[model samples]
Target chain A: MAELSEDRIAAYAASRLPGARDVAVSGLARISGGASRETYRLRLRYVDADGRSVERPLILRRDPPASLIETERHIEFAAYRAFHGSPVPVPQMLWLEEDPAHLDYPFFVAEELTGFESSPGALTGEAYDPVREKLGRRKWTILGEISRADPEALGLTTVMAKVAPEDCWRRELDYWEGVLDEDEVTPQPIIRAAIRWLRANPPPPAQKISVVHGDFRTGNFLYDAAGEIHGILDWEMAHLGDPLEDLGWGLNRIWCWGQNDLRGGLLPRDQAIAVWEQASGLKADPAALHWWELFNCVKGQGIWVSGAKAWSDGETRDPILIISAWRMFNPQDRAALELMGRL
Target chain B: MKPDPDAVLGYLAGLMVQTIAPQVQPQYLAGVIGMSGMLLGMAAQEWDRAADRLVKENRAIRGLFRQAERVGLDADLAQEVRALAGGQDDDLRISALESVNTGLRAALISLHAAVETRTDAASRALNDAIWAELSASTSRRAYTGSPF
Candidate 1:
């Protein structure tokens, strides 16, 4: 594994850009907080085919040796490319390399939406107080747009495995349950019980098999001072599943970062639902939505426990795994309990 | 032991989060260091209560197993619950206590699932008790910085 030097990245970019010269990858320092990938913000400078100098900010996401979740980089790149110019604000994906030889691991590069905030802690401050409601409205409205998309038209059907609307719940539930069974270092009695309940009573067929942004919580997107979401990032877990699944994830109580009653710490739960319904032109059936929300809690636990297992086994010594397990697991259980009416 | 373990951890965590993290470049590493600091802070909090919480929850789950025996359940499940109820956490080490807790809670899941199928007063009472314990367990392990 070669060191991730600027010279190496510059050479790789030069190779990718035909007829381009003086390609330099600079300021290639990693930005923190991505548990699944090593994310970095870099500057790409080059002379284009027209002999004009060009410079742009870009993001590099490379697969880690082990992570909280497993996902396909090509599918993520395809997802961003497909939704690039759509109502959804996804950064334009520029290059994808699967051959780990280039950077010692598979990675993809996309245009960075610079100067936008993605931290939930930042959104809850006095600076954002005035526009929190506006941000919430746009946040879920964008998700609604994603739910309303046609997977086949977006070329996602080919990349993301197709699933019958009726089988969506079973597929997601089984996969996450399998994750829990394999990765849990300790017995998860609460999540296990929730899984049993989810199996006994399943949600109805998905209204549509839209792209579920496997993680659409508050911190995953880029926002601004005026409460605008510039880019919907982190499509690693994106797949074709229930539209309500995305909605349910956004509405999960664990995301209430403001420590208030607001869903996503932005809007009331009903208000968020109404905004989504109006935007997607789809009804959020109460029972089915409830089922997905609880299922997401199970999924959330699976992810947290997997991180714990990865750390416990010395697969990765990253402290983020420990932080995630300590902060997330208990809340995930409580969220499931709340959905089950046992809280 | 002169300086309390928890106090030492707190000082180390503060250094990482407040002092070292801010001095680092590449904003992401700083954030990671900051999170490491927060995790250590929470760990310092957990250090004092780990064994006590595990033992108390283990005893509480064992008590539920005994109650599950009274609530109508299948022969195998009843036998499992009775066997769990008969056991005790003789080892107070956190690792031993947690290992025992896992087994007891796994059996409790089976017992709870069995009790859910029955409609008698005893089953309903046991169901209520199970929910209460699960809720209590979460609260017991609740970190001060819990997202909820």
Candidate 2:
């Protein structure tokens, strides 16, 4: 795999756009921190149908040889498309090319959301500190919109597989546990113990099946200094499941980047839940919410172990894989134990 | 040892953030170097206590496993526990201790699951001890920068 040159990418783009002329690409540089996909930012120049020259900043996300999470790109592309102009903001998906010949791998292109901070650390800085409350409100408010939106009505059901309202917990638990069963390099007594307890004591059926943004926590969105979220990114794990699953994931202790019990480093867990409940019109039964909270720990462990496996297999030499495996594996187990009352 | 592991890593972290990271091309590699520096800092924090913690935990687990034998655990589990309980650390190397620790923990998980469902008071007590040790194990590995 030689470096992905702008000329090559432009050539690929030109073939796709039949009426386009003077297709050129520049500023093609890889962006860091996306372990699951190869992300790049570039400026696309081309002539449109009216012969007007245009240069637009775009983002390219291509599948790596292996990923931290094995997800279908088509689903993610469809997910972004579904919520593009809705209350739950997302980037405009321009094209999805599955053919390997395009850039040596399947990739998707979207309008690059620019000039906005995406790191959670940015939220703790001076500029954002004043608007912390505003950010938190908008954060949960957007998530509430996602929970409140009807997947079938948004045409998401056509792309995402349907799940029974009652079977959401079982499907997620089984999938994550199966991953641990296959990829765990060592024994995970805490998570294994949590799994047994979950099976023995299951949560009630979901209030309703909603679009569960499987990874809707802080640090996965683009926000400006004024507390406006420009885009909700990373929908690779998005699926149709229990709404509380997304809510519980947002409350996972790992996202408490501020080293406190404040959920998502913004509001108290209960307050965040209340805001979400108020907006989504869903009841977050304490016991059921607890079940999903622990389940997210298992899911976290599964992701970390999968990243370790990817690194050990020599598929991707990205250090985030190793860092996640080393730093998160134990913390995730500890989270599970804390939730289980065993810590 | 004169300069100290933390001091060395602290200096390297400065170099990464201030000098090396700024000069790297292909932004991903630069970010990797920055993260690698952070990993070095974590490794420095672990370096001094790595061997001691392993030794302490190994001894602690063997003690728990020996107690498991007295609770009338199944023959296979008892034999495994007895063998591990009588084991001694022949090598002081961190890697050697870590290898032994991994084997011990694998056995510990089995012993815990075996005794968790038993009806006897002794089995219940042994299970509680296992859970307590597991909790302590996590605390020992916890770092100042841990998100949890």
Candidate 3:
């Protein structure tokens, strides 16, 4: 893989901006905790055809040699573009380059939503105590907006594969289960049992096939001290599926970072669900939501094991992979057990 | 070997977080150092418990296999269960115990799936026992301060 450099980024920016001169890239630094991609924060400066100097802080996400999850970059780009100005907040996507010849790997650049916090650990501090509830409300409310939005209207269906309402659970379950089958370093008897339970008691067909932001947990979004969400990020796993899948993922117990009953370490589970229901104008049928919650646990385990496998196989040396695997594997199993009423 | 590995690792983790991470250049490297500290802490916790956990779990799974005979599994599965149940964790090395543990757990999954199909009272009792064991397995692996 080609190493990311200021000159290479400048060259790519120059190519993208026709008639622009003296293009320069500076302050290029890789950011932390994006196990799926190599994310860099850089400043782009150039003189455009209009004879105006343009400068902007941008984020560059390039495909790594091995990723925690396999996803199509273009589809992720399209997802951002689809929701840029919508009710759901997302960074403005600037460019999507698929030709690995340009930067040694496919990548995309987007406007950096700076001066906000995204760490789940940050939310656990006393500084955020006052705004936690407000942030929690906005969190699930935005998720509800996403669940209510039509993939066809967002032009997402064109890029994302379409799925029937009934097959949403099966498709997602199959994909993640196959991930476990391929990448699990250790046998996951608990997840296997959960899978069997899910198959035995399938949820009612999705009320509607809405865009499922494959990962909608607390840490995936940017928030302010005032408890307002500035941008929703990490849509690499976005797809057309049952809207409840997103709901279930958000309500997962593994996200309760405070070690309390607060879902996502933000709001009580009932309050979050109520906020979501009110915003999306949809009913979260208890049984169906329960089914999706347990299914998300299985999906969660699949991801943790895959990271462990990637690290063990010498595919990537990123410490985040090993950290996440070690920290999350058992909690994920316990989450599954709780959901299955086996805990 | 003068100092215990867990103590050394714990001290190293504190050093990384309290000293090295803050001094590291480039935000990315700093974050890596901090997380490396966390991984070391987890390793420290697991080092003392891995062998004990694996041995106890191996014995528990063998017990389950023995009790599974009443469920009337198929010939091949029955033979496999019997073979695994008869074994003991004589080699106390972590690697050896883990190897045996994996095979036993795999067979346990097969037994679990088969047992779920039968509706007899014996099957029901065995199924309950399996769930109890599974729940206990999570308890055995649970880390202190775990979110769950």
Candidate 4:
């Protein structure tokens, strides 16, 4: 792998901007908690074709050699592009480069949503206490908007794989179960039992096929002290599926960062569901939602173990991978058990 | 060792989080240092209890296997369960105990699955026992500061 430097990014940016001059890149510092991508914050300076000197703060999301999840860069780029001007609040994507020769791997650049907090741990402090409920409402409302939006209208159907309402649960369950089979270092009897139960008792067909943000937890979004969400980020796992999938993922018990009954350390489980139902204008059938919630536990374990496998194999040395595996593995199991009424 | 490994690891974790992380640049390295400190704390917690946890868990699974005799599994699985049931944990090393534990747990999954198929009272009871053990297993491996 070639070393990623400021000059390489500048050269690439220059190439993208055909008539730009004095193209320079600086202040290149990596961001944290990107186990799937090498995320960096950089400053780009150039004199454009319009004879104007421009300086912009941008984000670079480059593919690592190995990642917790294997996803198509083009699909991720398209997801962000489709939802940029919509109510989704994603950063405007600038470029997507697949040729690894320029940056040692495929990467994309987008405008950075700076100066906002994205950590779930930050919400635990007293400073965020007053705004927690507002943030929770906004969180699920944005997710509701994402779920209710038409994939065909957004041009997402062209990029995302089409799945029928009935097949959504199986497709997702099979994919994650296969991930567990391949990556898990220890026996996952609990998840295995949950998988069997899910297969035996499938959920009803999705009310309507909608965009499922593969990850829609509290920490994935940028928020302000006023409890407003600015950008709903990390759409790398975005796909077309049952809309309830996103809600189930957000409602997963492992995301209860306060280690309490509060889901996402924000709202109580019922209130979050209510907020999502109102925003999306769709009913969350209790039984169907329960199935997806349990399934998300299996999916969650798959992600943690995949990261553990990557670190164990020496493919990447990102401490977040090990931290996730160590911190999340048991909670994920416990979450599954709770969903299965076995906890 | 003059000082205990748990104490040394705890001190190292504090140094990394309170001392080293604050001085790191670029913000990302600081976050990594902090997370490393957290991992060291987890490592310290595990160091003292790992061997004891594995031994107790191994013994518990062996007892479950002993009860598997009446579940009437297939011949191969029954023989396998019997064999595993008779085995003892003579090696006190964590690695050896863990290796045996893995095999037992893998077998436990098979037993649990087979037990689930039978509708008899004994099979049902054994199935519930397996679920109880599975739940207990998570509790055993759980960390003190887990977000769940």
Residue B91 CA error for candidate 2 (Å)? 1.8
True lDDT of residue A330, candidate 4 = 91
B1-148: candidate 2 lDDT, tens digit per residue: 7888777987787788678987998887788898887778778778888888899889999999889866987788889889999998889899999999989988988888888888899999998998888888888888767878
* Cα deviation of A300, candidate 3, in Å: 0.7
* Interface RMSD (Cα, Å) for model 3: 1.1
- The stretch of ten residues in a row with the least summed lDDT in candidate 4 chain B is B109-118
**Residue pairs with clashing backbones, model 2:** none
How do the residues B89-143 of candidate 4 rate in per-residue lDDT, one tens digit apiece?
8999999998999899899888888888689999998989888988898889988
Residue A222 of model 2, lDDT score: 91
Q: What is the DockQ of each candidate?
A: 0.74, 0.65, 0.75, 0.80
lDDT of 3 by residue, B1-148 (tens): 7598988998998899889999998999999999999888888888889999999999999999999888788899999999999999899999999899989889988988989767899998888888898989888888765766
Preferred candidate (lDDT higher): 2 or 3: 3
Clashing pairs in 1: A31-B28, A32-B28
* Candidate order, lDDT descending: 4, 3, 1, 2
Deviation of model 1 at A272, angstroms: 0.5
Off by over 4 Å in 4: none
Q: Write the residue-wise lDDT of candidate 3 on A207-313 in tens digits.
A: 99898899999999999998899999999999999888999998888899845679999999899999999999899999999999999999999899888999999
C-alpha lDDT of residue A190 in model 3: 89
Quote the lDDT for A20 in model 2: 93
Model 2 misplaced stretches (Cα beyond 4 Å): B22-26
Better of 1 and 2 by TM-score: 1
Residue A254 displacement in candidate 1 (angstroms)? 0.7
